[model samples]
Target: MDFIARATAIVGGTMVLLRRMSAPAAQAVGLTPTIPEAKKQGIMTLKMPTAKGWEPGHKPTAAQGLKVNAFASGLAHPRWIEVLPNGDVLVAEALQTERPPTSLMDRVMQATMKRAKAIGVSANRISLWRDPDGDGVAEVRKVFLEGQNQPFGMALVGDTFYVGNTDGIVAFPYEKGATKLTGPGRKLVDFKPGGHWTRSLIVSPDGTKIYAGVGSLSNIGDSGMEAEEGRAAIWELDLATEKARIFASGLRNAVGTAWEPVTGQLWTVVNERDGLGDETPPDYLTSVQDGGFYGWPYCYWGKTVDDRVEQDAELVARAITPDYALGGHTASLGLCWMPEGTLPGFGDGMVIGQHGSWNRSTLSGYKLIFVPFVDGRPSGAPRDILWGFLSEDEKVSYGRPVGVTIGPDGKSLLMADDVGDVIWRVTGA
Candidate 1:
């Protein structure tokens, strides 16, 4: 380790002494949860649990009657998952390459990213996994797509496939059962990059429109409003005209996008801003309305103003409150609706992948949670569906959950464990 790494490790150790909120209290900041007094730290707390590969014959513990099994293993940082109509599982073996640091905090963050095993040469490819025997294990795995940038979200509409790379959206010709793509893709739109880099893609129910979500460049317009142009919002693209427009705005980082089954309303799980104590502004899941602004720099949780940001009286008044809060700094990423009649007791709801947090002393998220819904609205508190990623000592992590989707059979829940490089399948035991 170099000087920056040593300094970061030492500071990380001292953050343990900082006052931290209990998990229950932090979660209470969820739907109508309390917002504690905010306190901006001199140096943002850094308490990420180091990654540790799973031991043999061990796996994550599933909820009550559900069972967890490895569908496929030995992947290269699988971060997103997509299942085809023919039951083939597609996993994006993607990771971010090393970015040059520009500031002291940037250097510290880079050192920590190395410890978390998140920085290196990205695989820049997607692989296809198949379990035709329905035996809960894959029998075939092959490279499906190659020569791509940092790809995350993927969608298939008819015979055309779309991928949301960190910088733009690309489309390729795809066949029903073919395992590989032989044609080069066309770019749809170029996204402005800043802080958050993940882009999630979702096609409209009618298959005519594509929704691409891009996150803000900075926590609160720190790079100036010019740097945030065409960012921190969801863009709707029309296939016929190849035209796009902003669908929603002021969402700091909308990484997960899904549509409610009954009402067809678009919903997203957003990662809120950091450095506001441990429970002031909670990350949330909200129904996206066209031309909506949810307040990123100026305020949060509806009308609660954040004095740290320059007051925007006009913008603050128009900020819409999110529908449901997930938790503070949970880093909620993947969002998918549960198919009805699957996973009894799981209820009609959406499963969220909380990739965990690094800005808190006690740590938050790092598991899969089920958020129940009724009549097109969030009904209750989130329930843990998969956990045990963090060790008992809270110093090591087996992996962190990211993308989530329903299997082609509509009975299994497919999850991506990026750090562990494994795809986990959850079914009713």
Candidate 2:
């Protein structure tokens, strides 16, 4: 093996054998989950599984009484899915650009990423897929928007379609049932580019505003606080005034957002910081409160202080606890919640796409989970609705799911698998 790959494997394997020092992943989930004390790491665990695309006739295993099929395939790193009002699906084809190798750690991480098949040029385009006959497969495909800057999130408000690129949010004019966007979009807001690059966008229930989730530039302001301005928070943008302001702060990486139907509240799934063992702090799904702060660099889970960050007792004191713990390093990203009748047996819950883990000795995610809700709040144990993203040996991955959305028909769930470059459709049997 090459030096970097071998080195990472040796370290990761050693940690697996020494996992007694870490908390089990199952202990860090659900509404009243445990948060074990942090174990500071000089070098975080590097356990990225090799990406192996699925063979012909292979697909992710669905839950009992559910069927899985590829809605569309051969997509270039499909990362997010948005279903239009007319049953059209929009898939974002985005890839992360390799950062310049300026430091030894940077070079090492880049090499590890290459071995895991993660280093790729961004396609920077969105495509529209249509299954006109109610078939699972999309028979009609077209490039909806091209020449974007690693776009991820997409939203449609009235006649305007908005896309959240890595550097900004842009708006495009749209016609009903149109497949292509011919004109350039106007920039709504600019974002500072760094570590957490995906910007998740969601329109308000009343359609008066747009909320954009911007992640931190560094894990814990390591790139400096100035570099993190206008990041690690959700920004509310007024549609009428074209003005924006920070909606909530101290979110490390809120990658998905949805409006709760019963309460009309905004909820998001956030990926937390790393380097504190495998299960110190958990990723979470929480209701977004305006002007609220959840601790990031200073603390977590509402006052479990992080010593690595200089003491900020005041800010830590004000940190709000997240609504649900998604387990440490799960990389929970895509979130979609529907009313009780949408999917049978998975009633009134949020469907989350966990993108899996790279920093844990043993993987924690790599599956889709359903968090049942009681009166707009998460309750009960999360149900595993989809699995088989990783190979049986657990050393190779068939795919990693990102964005998920309920189909326009309201009976299907669409998932974007970046590693497999396919859009998966899940439906009741």
Candidate 3:
């Protein structure tokens, strides 16, 4: 980082929030889920206020021939988001994973307004939002998939919308142009949603196979050192055959996966393990090779082994890690590769949602970043393309971005903020 950039960050860091409010809901869903009964207090819904010395928001305006607008607002923890054929969106809220409900004592707290209502988790479902008027806003949003575990990733294949639940995969006969879902489909696969279980999925461009990423069940393989039944791997399911097998392995957790239109190279953003004391292994965005390994608990960031887990530093020195380290704990997820060709406006660009940071002392990365790529490869380091969701000093300003997509209208961009349960669009005005 240059001096000016570094200095800007120092200014920005001051505003980062040091206190904890409502935890980044998506991160909680992806990592730890404590039983509500075990906790003495209710889940926090407070938005941590920004720090007094935080940097100012450097949010960008849509380039010429481009416009950005807020499509909808008032959402609750919008997690994995997918665009539908008829200009609608399918989203899952990781509410079901909100620790098992508490007991009578917890109920007392609820009655006293100390906790949220309902002991049972309603998070196990997906919701649909539609912008029928096409006025650059979602006028309606309703539940589409229900009774789920931790419904996260979603993909549309013809009439079937594949929903990735914490425990498995299910297909629903999703209807377009409708604000509600009332039908059920079939289950494609049953999975073990554990340690690292935020499933991100995509269908092959040709539409024959489905690729779903399942994160590690252990912090690194060491937690489950012995059990390897589908831990830390991306599995490919033959859409025509319904058979699933490991597609790639050793990725601690690859949250976002997309195919570069110009080159068809696979790209991903992975969440490397934590507890390496804040600076060890860096999370990354890289082109994933089929049958290749981006070492997890064993290595990271161009083959740097984590000394905490791997005893032999020599082995860590040899492993191949990710191509681009997206800094530590930025929590990059839901990737979208830009336009078809090498246009000046976008140099084979990619957009990643940096879902903010926890586990670290000060807050960082709760916005969108642009990773410019060319000729099917990264041309340079990522720059904060879309920022300001988190306050200048560390408090959340507007909302946390979970997913990014081209609007159903095909001209603008849509970003989902999980906390607000809202969808905002950036389009040509």
Candidate 4:
């Protein structure tokens, strides 16, 4: 290994030891998770499982009465999924753009991500999949759109397909039965890129507006809050006029978004800030209110002040507490609403794809989970819908789940496994 790689490996090993000696193995999770006192670390926990793609005949473990199969394989870092009106599936393949390490932490993160097989040239395209026979496996695959700027989220509203590129929301004229889009698209809104780069898009239920999740440019606004303007919030774009405004503010890295069917409220999964010990603040699933603030760079988990950042007593007081915690550093990034009986024993709830964590000592959220809901609020504890992403020893990862959506058949679940380069379909066994 090179000097930086060797240094990173040594540092990572030391952090693992320090973590074991300092804190308990259990991490806080669920709606009423125990929030431990923040234990700041000089180097912070940096334990990431080495990426090992699934072997032949290997697959994730599905919940009881359910089975999983590869809906499509041989993808290139597929991170997001969208189902079209014509029963077609669209998968967005992209990865983070490598930036030069500016600090020791940056160098460690870069090296660690490389070790985890996360650093690579983005595929920068969306592929279309078709399962005409309803056999779960997609026999037809085509490049629907190429040369996107690290696209993540996708939506189609009345012939205009919207894609949330890292730097902007782009719109293209999409026909109902067309297999590919060949026209140059127009930019709907520009977003500041880098830092947390995945832009998740969801259209309003009434189809009048589009909401885009824009994450912070830095953790805790370390680069100065001024650099974080127009970020760390969801932006709403009115289709009538080509204008956009911040819908909700202070979400650290609000990613996947979905609308609740019962109450028609917008819900999102947020990845909280790091370096605050194993369980100071938890990543959350919450109903996003318009003009509401949830607190970032000022407070977290409702008015629990994070003293590390510059204090804003007024903003902190107004900070709204998130509804549910998904565990600290779980990296909950994908959200979708599942109606009752979407899966055999699963009731109506939100399905979340936790991309898993690299910041905690013991890993958290390397699987797909379901949070049962009643009326419109989270009612019960989360249950694993699919797991076994990590090896028994937890040092090797076979796959990482990102985006999730109901399958075209409306009876199954489709999830994107980026590291494994496959789309998995889940249904009744």
Highest TM-score against the true fold, candidate: 4
- lDDT, residue 352, model 2: 97
For model 2, the run of ten residues with the poorest summed lDDT: 18-27
Clashes of each: 2, 0, 28, 0
Candidate 4 lDDT, 1-429, residue by residue in tens: 247766776787788777867665566767777888887776777888888999999999998999999999999999999999899999999999788889877887887787787876899999999998989999999999999999999999998999999999999999897789987899989999888999999999889999999999988998999899999999999999989999999999999999998899999999999988877788999999999999997999999888888899999989998999898888998899999978899999999999998887778899999999998999988999999999987788999999999999899999999989999999999
Report model 3's TM-score to 2 decimal places: 0.76
Number of residue pairs clashing in candidate 4, backbone atoms closer than 3 angstroms, sequence gap of 3 or more or interchain: 0
What does candidate 1's lDDT look like per residue over 1-429, in tens digits?
367777887887776564553323435345677777677776877777777868988899899989999999999989899898888999988886777788988888877877777777788899999998899899999999988888888889999999988888899999889999888899988886435777789999999999988999888788788888888899999988888999999898998899998899999999998877666578889999999999887888887888878788998999999999887888899999995677867789989999998777777888999998889888977899999988877778898999999976788899999888899999999
lDDT score of model 2? 0.88
TM-score of each candidate?
A: 0.97, 0.97, 0.76, 0.98
For model 2, residues 250-277, the per-residue Cα lDDT tens digits are 9999999999988889999999999997
Clash count (model 2, backbone only): 0
Best-first order by lDDT: 4, 2, 1, 3
lDDT to native, each model: 0.85, 0.88, 0.63, 0.91
lDDT of 4: 0.91
**Candidate 1 Cα misplacement greater than 4 A, ranges:** 1-3, 21-26
